[model samples]
Target chain A: MKFLKLSMSATAFAAAMAASTSAMAEEYKMVILQSLTGGAAFIGKNVADGAAMAADELNANGFFGEGNSLVYEVADDATDRTQTLSLITRLAADEDVLIVMGPTSGSVALAGANVANEREFPVITTTNSMEVIENGPWSFILTQPADVTIPYIADFTAQTLGAKNCAIIGVKDNEAYVALQRKYEDLIQAQGVNLASVDGVALADSDFSALATKIATSEQDCVFIGTPAAQGANLVIQLRQAGLDPSIPILGHNAFASPTFIEKGGAAVENVYLMGAWVPGGYDDFSSAFSTNFEAKTGIPADEWHAVGYSGMQVIANAIKDAVAAGAVTREGVRDALGTQTDIPVVMGEGTYSYDEHRVPHFGMKVLQVKDGAFAVVGE
Target chain B: MLSQQILNGLVTGSVYALFSLGFTLIFGVQKLLNFAHGATFMAGAFIAYYCTISGLPFLLAIGFSMVATGVIAILVDLIAFRSLRKRGNAEFPALVSSIGVDLILVSIAQQVSKTQVLNFPFGTFPVKFYTFMGLRISLLQLVILATVAVLVALLIFYLKKTTFGRQVRAVATNERAAALLGVNAQSVYLQTFFIAGALAGLAGVLIGLLFNSMQFLMGEPYMLRAFVVVVIGGLGSVPGAIVASLMLGVMQSLTVAYLPSGLTDAIIFALLFVVLLIRPNGLFGDANAVAGGTRQ
Candidate 1:
């Protein structure tokens, strides 16, 4: 009886130890790179904050798994391509890191894509460069490519807004802006709109007085601003001040999503139309939840950058959780899981967001108009 | 349209001339390239922006920003160039040092702005327009032209008539000789820096308003354009900088209007290259553009 009782006690203690082991949770960390400084810092900083907000909520609610939590660290790239390259390599080399995300710019992300492939590390980012997709499979992008979105916006401007001729102006040195403008021109011409003159300025150019005069007198029905938010805003303001008829519409792209455009352009941007990757008013349940939670944490209403960042984080966490569920926690396992993710719920895309065989994520967008210092859905 | 474009160019060029004049002024006296001059320009805009948001009147904010930037320019000299100047070999080292200081200032600005572009509150300046001879011009443009003219005239008059001007010219001719002749060389340097910085600051405010946007790196392109203006104007010639700035502005405007798109910088830089090849000393520059400031 004594031996039997002793055996039973040992068995109970063994079972208790096993139960405790199962209850223990492990922490995983992902590294994010953003241009928290330099020219692109406005977007980079917001995206990083959005990702951080998502990670916080996931950790609090234990969304990853029964015993797993997600945490993140953000490193500033300062919008330099070479620095981004170095940061990606360094972050990937860290054995404790689960994944890497972001640089917040498509033009700058071209450098990081090569590193991701070489390191065989998964770099999920909101960088929307199609050329980056060709670089390697390691880079999983969340934002719609400029080629896809710009053309769509151009069609809307030419067709819906009824612009007969649209003049273009932007910094010539920026390949991204140049590419975007070229795409817009192509689409508008395809839609039977006349192509007006394209005005190009060097980067960091302040005064648009001369360009404004040319555009105002050119008789274009509309003008497509192929520049960043700040530059575009200043240009439009100058154009209006230089006697461009306020009746003529102004067209823009993702840069208009930035609050800077409206804030800086003020009365000038009224009635301007632009495409957004995410329309907050479009009403996605997931987006709404993320916005509410993010506002609660950061005290600022989440915008496009925030939505992209949050969506990217959710995708990463879901991939990791899938890898964990399959009992394969390796980097490759996480990457493969991302590849096979089906019908994943996201905040930014329209109508059944999913990845194609080429590893490019496809989503829909909206065209918005500036009304009374706020963005209103164009058709709605 | 052609006349309108010319007017537009002149208006834009006036600001360029205002900005370039300060840059040339520094080279005129100290004979050292203060790349940090751009930082002072950026700072002027920022200071004015903050002052405006703090509820200071527009004109008052402009004055405060001017004073603050002048002081900031002096501080830049103290930190970046003075030590090198004291050591008696200030040229290359000063250039490198000024570039370093420019980076630090830009970095600090980036942090302060959180990388967001700033705009003055609407109605910071009255927006009124005028049309004459089929050329439409805003009241702001008229003000900019008048401001540039008045400031340039005042600068020229001050340099030509003042005792301080004589000292500065004496130092420009020969720092050691000026020091031997009882001209306080250091004081002259500080004064020139202040003047240059004040002009740059004023230019910054005008630009911040004209463009309706301000960013940490806003001064960079102006610096490049101003460098071209300074080089083409003859490195240390104030008059040269003004004429070249206006000419470049008109040419740039014309090119954008008539030429193929995206050819403005190429045309400008090509002109710069041609000028360098043809007149090495520049259109108005003297042979001794460096002056005899290279001393120990």
Candidate 2:
């Protein structure tokens, strides 16, 4: 009887230990490489916040299998391409990290894409360059490429705004701006708009007096600004002050979508039309929830990058959930699942994500205009 | 179009002249290359920006910026150049030191601004334009030109007519000898730095208002252009700086308006290189090494 009782106790203890082991959750690791401490830090901070918000929401929703959790690690790339590659390599070598997101800029994203392919790890970048996916199968981009978006901007400026002649002002010596200027040249010509002249302004030029005077006197129907936000704002302000008709339409690139432009440009940027990647007001239920929760948690207004970051992470989460459901949750499995993910719900645009054969997300954007000191949807 | 461009160039050139004058002035007095002069200029803009944001009147903001930048310039000398000057090892060491100080100032500005571009509030300056002889100019341009003219005249009068100006000239010739002659070299250095800083600050505020963009890095490009202007104008020669500044401004405007965009920088710098090669003493420069060392 004594031996039997002792055996019974040992069996109970063994069963209890097995039950405890089953109750503990398995954690999947994700690593993010973003530009957090350099020139792009402002955008980088938003990206980081959005990703964290998605991760938290996913974990809370139990989207992963029962007793499974997602964990993340973040590192700053300082907006440097070489640094991005190094960080990606380090993250890829880690067996624990299931997937990676970012290296925010296009130039840096190009390098990151190659690293993802070489290491057989998946990288989802928010870079606006379509060329990012050319690095191969494992590389993905979440934002609209400039080529796709610029045409729309040009078409709208020509058709909707009825601008006949347009002067192009761009920052010289920037590879991106130079490319943008050429794209504008092509698109404006296609729309039968007379390209008055292309003016290349130096970066950090405090006096735009000459350029402004030239543009104002050109008698163009519109001025298209192909510079970053700050420079664009100053250029427009100086242009207006130089006696350009206040009613002349000012067409802008994606960079002007930032509220900073409206704030800095003040009364001058009043009729500025911007083609932007994200439309916050177009949020679906899923996006609305993410947006609400994000603001509640971070106390910062969500911008284009916030939406992209959250969407990128949501796609990652869905892939992980599918991988977990298949009982094959390796990095390769998550990547394969991402490859097969179609029409996954997102928070930006129409709130659905579909990937091309190249694994680049279908990036739908919106036309935004600043009216009454705030951003409002154009052609609503 | 050419006339308008020329008019624009003159407006922009006046500011360049104002900036380079201070730069040459310091070199005239001490023969020291104060790299931090750009930072001093930047600080003026920053101060003026804050003052405006804090509800100070527009002209008051300008005054505050000028005074603060002037003081900052004196501090730069006390910290970066003074010890080296005392050791008589100021040339290269002072250059390196001023650069170091410049970096520090830039870093501080970056932190203060959070690496964001700032703009003056609307109505910081009234915007009105005038058309004359088929050419257009803004009220701000007119004001800038008038202000520069007045400042230049005042500077000329002070330098040519005053006892302190004579003392400064004496010290510029030979500091040790000037001190022996009871010129009080210390006061001369302080006054020259103060004036230089104040002028730079005024230029900073003007440029900031003109562009409607105030940023920590704005002074960098002006500093670079100042080099070209002072080199062309004959370093240390105030009148030479003015002429060279106007020339460079016009050249830049014409280049941008007519030449291939990529060639502007190459052309400008090539001009600088040619000037250095052909006339190392510069067009208006003295045979003496020190800027403004010769009256002619």
Best by DockQ: 1
Score chain B of candidate 2 by TM-score.
Answer: 0.97
**Global fold similarity of model 1 (TM-score):** 0.92
Query: For candidate 1, what's the TM-score of chain A, rounded to 2 decimals?
Result: 0.87
lDDT of 2 by residue, A1-380 (tens): 99999999999999998888667878989977777655565556578778888888788877775767889888888778889988999888888888887877657778888888898888887676667777777887766565766787888888898888888888674444566677877887888999888878766675776778767777788899987677788888878876889888998876776656877798889978987766543346766676577667765456667777888888888888898888888988888898888888887665677776766667566778888887787877
TM-score of each: 0.92, 0.83
True contacts kept of 1: 0.82
Off by over 4 Å in 2: A1-102, A106-126, A136-142, A162-164, A245-248, A279-347, B84-93, B182-190, B287-291, B294-296
Individual DockQ of the candidates? 0.57, 0.37
Model 1 Cα lDDT, one tens digit per residue, B36-119: 988889999999999999999989999999999899899988999898988986899999999998999899998788666788
Candidate 1 Cα lDDT to native: 0.81
lDDT of 2 at A306: 76
